[model samples]
Every structure is written in C-alpha cells, then in structure tokens.
Target chain A: MEIISFASAVAGLGILGIIFGTGLAYASVKFAVEEDPKKIEIDEALPGANCGACGFAGCSSYAEAVAKGEEGIDSCPVGGEELIEKIADIMGVAASSSDEKKTAKVLCQGGNQETFNKAEYQGVPSCQAASMVDNFKSCQYGCLGFGDCAAVCDFDAIVMNDNGLPEIDPDKCAECGVCVTECPRSLIEIVSSNEDVITNCKSALKGKEVKVVCEKGCFGCTICAKKCPVDAIEMEDNLPVVDTEGCIGCGVCVKNCPTDAFVEVDF
Target chain B: MQELFLLFMAASITNNFVLMQFLGICPFLGVSKEVPTAFSMGLATTFVMVTSAVVTWLVETVILVPLGIEYLQYIAFILVISSFVQLTELFVKKVSPPLYKALGIFLPLITTNCAILGLALLISMEGYGFIQSAVFGLGAGVGFTIAIVLMAGIRERLEFADVPKPLKGAPITLLVAGIMALAFTGLAM
Candidate 1:
C-alpha cells in the first residue's frame, strides 16, 4: 500500500510538471521575438570589440544596421581592413575599399615652453576643468597646462613632456581620438596626418588683440597667407585656413610663419 | 494581482535579493559605478529573470517529472537558461535592434548571471504555482534594480566628495552597501 502511495505521489508530481512545462514552452515560443539570422552571421563576422568606435552602440548594433542596409561595413575604426573583408564576404557583396586609412595629428605646437603660464594652478590640473573654468592662469584659450589628453589615451601614444605639454608619439598613435574627445578646450582635432601640413593655432583675434591676453596668441598676422605660392592658405579672422585639396605640402608656410604656429606633426 | 503585490513587496524591500541575499553581486559592483550603465544592466537582468522563471517552471513540470529524471534538474535548468538567453538575444537583435543596442552586452551576459538562477531556484523551492512564480521573479528583479541604481546615483555624487585613502574605491562602496542594507532592513517591519 505504501509502495502504491509513493508511486502515485511520483506520478502526481510528474503530471503537474508536464502541464507546467508545456505551458511554459508555449509562452516562450508564443512571445518569442523574430530575429534575423543574418544579423548574427554579420555580428560573428565583426571583430566583436564592443568599442563603440563606429558611432553605433556596439558591434551587434552595427551588424543589424548592415543587415538592414542602414550602415556601410567600413565605419568601424578599430576593426581595420581584415574585419571589413570578413563582413563583405558574409554579406556576399564585393568589398568596397575606397575609404583611405586616415591618421590623427595635433594641429597646434603650443607646448608649455611655447606658451607661458600666468600662475601655478593648485587645484584639479586637468585641461577640461581648466578650460571650463579659469584657474590661476589668466588666458582663457590656454591648454590649462593640464594633461587630461595624456590620461585618457588607451594606446599610450600621448605623453606629457617635461614642458607641461602633450607630445604625440609618431609610431604609437592609433588615431583613436580619445584625446580629441577628452579635451575641454576643443584644442584637439582629427586632421589627416598623411595628407599634408596643418595650422595648429585656433586664435581668431588679430595680433594686437590676441597678444594682450596671450603671449602665444597668433595675431591675425597673415604671414603664412602672404607666403603660400598656391593660394591654399586663407586668412580668416586672423587665423590661417589651408585648402587641403590644392596645398601640395609646400614648405613655404612653415618657414614664413613668424610665431611658428604652422608646423608639421611628422606623420 | 494580490500575489504580484506580495512578490513586489518581498522582492523590492523585504527579501531584497541584491542587498539582502547577495546573488548577482558581480554586476552589482562592476556596473553600478555609473548611473546609465547600472540602469541598463538592471533592466536587462529583469527581462532575463522573468522569462527564465516562466521557462524553468515549465521544464520542471513537464519534462523531468514524468520521465522520473528528477535528479537531472540542476544541469537541465542551467542548460535551458543559457540556451533560452541566447535564443532571446538573437531574436531581439534581429527584430528590435534598438533595444539590443540600449541593453549592450548585458543582454547576452545575463545568462550566467546568478540572480536568474537563484530566482528559478527560489520559486521551485517555495513550491510556487505559475502566477506566484511570475510575480516572485518580477519582484526579485525589481529589488536588484533598485539596489544597483541607488548605489550608482550615490557613487556618482561621491565622485566629487573627498574620501579617505583606506576607504577609497571598493572599501567605501562596500561600506555604503552595508548602510543601504541596514536601511532596507527597516522596510521589513
């Protein structure tokens, strides 16, 4: 009798479990979302770094975009060329390789030795906070003599030289733009490192107007503007804008600039 | 409805899984330092918990009991949880790409998250019916979310304040968690 009772108990549990299991399986399948298998394939083809370097949230999102035809495959900066090829092959499309590999270079030459600091800042010495609020230093456009750029760099390409200015290592640069995004002064720019030379100074005020507040100020002095033989350099609001298309990497502007603001990053 | 309220009360304050029981502490600590990240992790964990509870209840009721393979529950539960999360991830990625983006990697990582496992175990151990299990899972997830998010907001503010050397980093955070647990313990009465 006890054996029969035990068997019945087991059977009771079994039937209850079976009923619940079937119900659950039904709900799971019923509520189950329809997902594209192609997105998974594309995601697998991606580098899976989750770096968010491609302006999307993550690699999976990028894959979904590729599947829906919303995004091109080459936008991933960290994925490089090989991953691009993998993605193209997965999609059964011919790989488009027109996007040139571009590198980032700092346009300005304003190191600590180049620009004079008004006073030694005691508090948070980060460039972002310094740019946001004036410190003991008098100038507003000053690099704040802080090394926030050096701090956030993932590749260790940027280091604070003894002069209290960030110097970029030519070989170590991955062109990740952490520094460009980190800088509070908007001092960092993603210029084409390979194309040609660039003007670093962002000062718009003319020579006399700029010189009073800053010693390193590039006064609307059009020295580079007058010297460019190809008319590639244009002087706007005391700043020199180079038309990168026509300017043929001529050494004329670098030599002519009296403040020496226009210099090569040696990319 | 009453069952859901009871589960909510239990998960949100009284039985409080994260602050009280200490399941799923890895993400609670790692991701809780930032508000946005902690919030997203909480939501993703909740979604996984609710779904897993429903599925595990079914697997136990239907597959194992009838066949008398009751001993295989542990491994079977784990297998079902992982595969379910993976299938859900793929499905969500295809249909709602935006949700997958917003949730980030936590969408897939929650498969191994112990909180989901614990919720499944808790419901089974308590011998909860289907409705009771769902409510309990929902409550537990809410509890976890509340704990992590509150910690995140406090940590963000704490970043500006000057903290002592020994109490800096993990130490201070843990101390804060203790205080939070103490505070939530008051909810029991």
Candidate 2:
C-alpha cells in the first residue's frame, strides 16, 4: 500500500529473521529424539495406580521396562495376576503369575479394653515413637492404635475402630505394603489370605504377667502348641506360632487358650 | 547470551506460567493427577506455545505492522492460536498417533489454555525480536511442563498421604502449592 517498504524492512530485519528462524528450525530438527510409541501404550495398559509395588519407582519406569524387553512379565503387585496376564498378552511374553495371595493383618489385638497407658501421647502419635520411651500403652508389642496404617491405605481398606485400633478390610487391600512401611510399631504383617488363624498377639511375655496387662494379651503358654494334633502350632519365644500350611483352621488352640489370647479369627 | 539465559531462567522460575504467573492453572490442576496425562498435557502445551509464538510474531511483524492494523492484535492472536492448535493437533495425529490418543480430548481443551494467549500478549507487549519471543514462549512452556509434572508426582504420593480432613482437596493442594512456591524461592535467588 505504501510502495510496500519491503526493501527498507529487509534491510532492517529480514537477515536477522532468516538467521534466527533457520537456527531454530535446525535445532528443532537436530535435537529431535526418536521415542517408542508402545512405551506409552504399555504404560496405559498398566493399572495407572503407581502403587510402587512392582519394585520399580513408578509406572513410567515400569512402562520403560515393558518396552525394553528386560524385566519379566509379572512385576506390578497391586495390579495383581490379571493385570500382569493382560500385559504379558500385550507384550507377547510369558506371564509369571506369583500365586502369593497375601493380605496385611494387624498383629496386636490389645485394644482400649486390653491396654493401659503410662502417659498420654500428644502430637504425631506414631507407633514407632510409642515403642521408644514409655509406650503409649503398657504392652510393648501392642498396636499404638494411632491409625498410621489406616492413613496410608489407598483403598478404604482400613478403618480405625472405637478402641483406637485399625481394622483391615481384607477384600480391599492389594497388599501394596505401603501401610506395612508406614506403621511405626511394625505390628502389621502380610499373611496368606487363605490363612484363617494367626496369632494376633506378638508379645513374648509369659503366663499371668501378660494376662494382667491386657484382656486379649497372649501369654507364652505352650498348651496350644502341645495339644495340637497336626504339629502346626509351635511355641516360639513363649508365643504359639501357627505354620500356615499345617493350620487347618481347627479351633483346638482357641479352645485351649487360658487367657483368650489365641482367639480364632475365622472359626 | 546472558539475556537469553536470564530470560530462560526468569520465564521458567521467576515468572513460572503455572505457579507464579498462574497462567495454565486449568491443566495444571486438572490433568496433573497422573504422570502420563500430565506429561502429555505439558508436551502438547509446549508444542502449541512454540508454534503460536512463531506464527504470531511473523503476523505481528510482517502483516499487522506493515498494514498498520496493530489494533487487531487480540483478534489476530486468537485466530492464529486456534488455527495453529488445530494444525498441531493434526500434525500430532499424523506424526504421533499414540501421543495424539494419549493427549486424547485434552488437545482440544488446550485451545483454551490461557498460557498460550498470555505468551502471545507478553511477546507482543515486550516487543521481543522473533527469536527472543520464541525463546520466551518455549521457556514458558517448559516452565508449565515442569510445574504440572512435579505436581503429578506429588499428587501420586499424596494419594497415599495422611492429610487431615480439613486439608483435603483444594485446601491441601493449595498448601502443597504454597510449599512448592516456598521451594521455588530457592530458584528465585
């Protein structure tokens, strides 16, 4: 329109524009990295939970593993066997199904009914701390009942009961072990889901001393161990240990406990 | 070189698109729950940001200035940004279909990402030369990407965190953002 002052503009900025744009275009082309598309797909096929149960840091690394053909099939523990099987089908690899059906169970049954507190705990009542000095309660191996495990469960698998104890919902728990790591007292343990009987009491004290402390406390009495017909129960550190395979869910041990410590959970 | 480096750092941290400028908070909060979604959104925004900056600069310098239609900046920028996003969407679809799908519906949603518009406005307002403006836009995009991805990582951990009931949802996120802002203070110095 104004004689198209193009010559003047080119004189002012055309060379600079050309130089910069070309430099950028070159950089964009030169620095481009070829990324595999399947890496993303494999990652999407993953449960997207990022539960960190697969030994990898998160899902992205798991996706990288799936793409690289390095790691074996079944890695994501939270995704479970079904997800691993699907991933194996996608990657055209053999599915390594780990049949370990484990669920987190609280070892301590010393609720408000059983335990007495030496001192009132205030501020971040972690089980680890309760285990240090004067325990929040009298029993050393009892649940601090601070609900730390309830706090870390991604699924609503845990609810703190009225007695300051966390009850784990076995169906909702994926056994990611986040709660296991989060618990300070180490009272939470993973046992086979099929295991109907486990010693809720982890204390090693014996006889009347343990009975005086808590209503649900187990004294290291070998009566349950000695009276077992299948040799499943054994006295270890004064506490009766039930071998999971040998435990046929028989209530013989429950019937024999003098302190009502070894109550049958399923029976 | 110092100007370029300082511009890069300033755009990335001192004037972050997500946390500082609060430019792309929609995608920052929305798509940041998962690393994959957050990453895809960041990458797509980066792509859109760089493209719009280049085209808008060209339009502003070549056509608008020459034609004395500088008043048409907001309209011109919007039109160019929309077309550029559409083209980028098509390009991503053709070039990287999986990423396109991964980007999914968020691609279209990014058309509304104000960070792109903000970059266009800032570049035009600052009167940066084409390369400087493009660099600024890229820096803003990278800054946005960094913010959202870090947010995603934190949110993943937060899913298992024992945050209080009163601090759930936006309250906790705001607290996290405040902490992140405090963390960013180190970079500002």
Using DockQ, give the best candidate's number: 1
Candidate 2 residue pairs in backbone clash? A220-A238
Which candidate tops TM-score? 1
Report the lDDT tens digits of candidate 2 across residue range B1-189.
899988888988887888888787666766677787678778777877887889889988886687666666686677667655655555565576677666633555566678888998999889999889878988998999899889889988998999898886657766787788788877775
Query: What DockQ values do the models have?
Result: 0.15, 0.08
Model 1 chain B scores worst on lDDT over the 10 consecutive residues at B104-113
lDDT tens per residue, model 1, A160-187: 8786667777567666788888887667
> For candidate 1, what is the lDDT?
0.73
Off by over 4 Å in 2: A1-38, A42-101, A119-123, A263-267, B1-25, B28-52, B59-114, B117-189
- Interface RMSD for every prediction, one decimal? 8.8, 13.0
TM-score (second chain) of model 2: 0.92
